[model samples]
Target: MLSRLSPRTWLLAAAVCAVLAAGTSLVYGGARVQPASWPQARPEPIALGRPPALPWPSHGQAAVAVAGQAGTLRVYGKQRPVPIASVTKVMTALVILRDHPPGGPSIRVDRQAAIESGNRDESTVAITEGQSFTERQLLELMLIPSGNNAARLLARWDAGSEEAFVGRMNTTAAKLGMKNTTYTGASGYEPTTVSTAVDQLKLARQAMKDPVLRDIVATARTTIPGVKGEIVNSNKLLALPGVVGLKTGTSTPAGGALLWAAHPTSGDRDRLILGVVLRQGEPGDALEDRKKAAFVASRRLIVAAQRSGWAKTR
Candidate 1:
């Protein structure tokens, strides 16, 4: 073939062969080619300064954090586990909603519930035995009024026994990374039900994700069937600006415990702030006084958090 072609034509064929070999080499090469911008590394946004100092309570334990974000923003007082009172109902509500959704079948008010409701020492929503309420309604009774009986009833209905339901509650706490939490009862009536502020703050972050729970906790007051007067949310912090749902717990052993969630007035609506204040005062103090102390401390923390721009920051 080389002898048959003219000199100029042979040179042209040789050039074409070289070009093909180059193309083949490029195709078989292990190196990957990409657009200039595609391979360039992006600079990560750096945190500009330390997290602003929050006005943490001087007594008891407290923690503040943000939803959809990791880690606590600030903490105060002791971090050890202590009685959490009715805040235990938050876990109960989560478990109920997990096993039985909002609109599921109604649960009958049992003798235990009626007995609990009649007790003068505990917080409860009065209900007659044999009367029934749906899952959503029962949740309202449990969370809004901080009903002790309603919590236990929902626990039993979900797991066939309160003890069994408490096991589930502990399991759920462990799943949520609440290592310092322990649940001996769904109602949190027993002094044995204990948790730390940091642990409860973690729970607040997760519980607020459920829209149903969010709605119920944010409700300040509501009327339920068979209940005479309107039932009010124990979390008085709901009255504060941008404040939303969460829960409150109070008992002789727990003192006053609160877990709260909120958003800033002038920031992204999706941004949520979470807080927990526990054992605000001496346990032997009047229940209302102790609860008021918790509310006051939480109010200070939330306001300080807002002023410090927690909602707008990372």
Candidate 2:
């Protein structure tokens, strides 16, 4: 029978046997034959690190996210978004700066801006109507004093109206991956304006990158061209060593909050841990008491991250 078969038949049978052998080897758990030159993959290196825990607020809610070379080390809280008050200005400032990269354009403070400052109970630099300020000066007044009016003027001038500016604020927040945040106005005066500490950290990191904003926030105090009485940053924490500028927020519903950026753990000036502490105490606390609560809570977070291996030594 083998001799009767043609050469083509023999070749076909040989091919079928080879295929069957390969299939059987595959099904029967035979070792796969790798190429002689096949390269082996090395295991990824693991850093010996532990997640950070808390000494967080016992009264009001607070959340923190610590970032190192490996990315966000960990986060704490209900992780729920809450009212963020004037910390809202950080978004206001970021949107304006992004739209106007050449920031020296002049802004004519309108009567409404002055009225908003004087009539409302929020922070302000009291920019007067018809008073012209260079963009940088405006930024100085707004960021340093935690000025609600300055934020309004900037939003209106940059986007042609306050509503439009706020629209831009929400849009910018969305782009920053702050899905849990919302901005209803230029200043975070309204209780409806809110965010989580985790969301705010994203905004904080992006905001710190702008040289103009970076310079403005890091300043403990400075005199603007037209403003009387030296413009001091409301963030007294700036006076603390390694403490730098970001912003602070307060309101009846929001309690006291702060967004902070600085090198607390590692002495490296270039590496900074961005921290967000929101609603640090009962809503009805006195203004100074609320502020203290926020400050103390944030400081504890920084200390926790630093000692718990989130911070690298300088």
Candidate 3:
């Protein structure tokens, strides 16, 4: 009966078989067939342009360090040891991360950090005593808001005493060759705690290497478990382009100081750029002006580094 079919019927039956015998394949008899071959094309590489010029500002001591095969720095008065203000928290954070990994045990906030926060009257996340937070969360509180209380908490947690933690800080600084650096407290609140711009830069470089600390400092704002609202970053430069983590400081002696870093991005193929601005603003300047001076100074150095093309070896 199959062999007796007419020519057109045979053709139609073959087409039906072709459609059904494919075992649910997409190819059909009436479907348009596309070309099996295609033209080959490769995307052209982008040409790197000349770096823009970076103007050196006159009001502050600053430096810019690039991270790469040949890390170089453009600096002004980086050798002078001065007060780093709250920038000490960077060291506090780095030391804590070095000893205790990010996901370590939760530490209950003691009244000491809260009492010290109120006594110092500096920036704080207002974490009450008996409130529990992970080491990572405590880091966010310390670095993001420049919380002195948080620094003290980490210090005590790590060394069992603030003095002992500070001792370790000095030991670490010495090991890192921060010759001009000194630590009197976990927070940079003590005028006695001092360091050169370059020394802080060294600390910043180390801090940026840690994923947990890097992520925490890069956050613009974060809410503490017990705190009511977001504790924003004290480093105002964080809002600027390419400006990322590290720390900031301001005090009667320290003036305004900032340790800032820039990460790699598609638009800027350059390596990491770290900038530090120390002793900015006039003695009697407004509070915001003092703060803005450090931020602006740090941003200027970053602009210069970017303009000069961080890829070029000095």
Among the numbered candidates, top TM-score falls to: 1
- The lDDT per prediction is 0.84, 0.78, 0.77
Q: Report how far residue 228 has shifted in candidate 1, in Å.
A: 1.3
Candidate 2: C-alpha lDDT: 0.78
lDDT of 3: 0.77
Better of 1 and 3 by lDDT: 1
TM-score of 3: 0.78
Please tell me which predicted candidate would have the highest lDDT against the true structure: 1
* Per-residue alpha-carbon lDDT of candidate 3 for residues 140-237, written as tens digits (9 for 90 to 100): 88888877888989999999999999999999999888999999999888989988877877777777888888888889987766777878888766
TM-score of 1: 0.83
Clashes of each: 0, 0, 0
Cα displacement (Å) at residue 285, model 3 = 1.7
The 10-residue segment with the lowest total lDDT in model 3: 32-41
lDDT (10s digit) by residue, model 2, range 1-314: 68999999999888756765554322224665322332336765655334467677665555454444555544556767788889998898898889887546588889988787686577877667789988888887888888888888888888888899988999988998999998998888888898988888888878988898888899998887777888888887787667777898877788889888766444344567788788877756887788888899888776776566655431
Residues 100-178, candidate 1: write the lDDT tens digits. Answer: 8777677898988888888888888889899988889999999998888889889888999999999999999999999
81: Cα error in model 1, Å = 1.0
Please tell me which model should have the higher TM-score, number 2 or number 3.
2
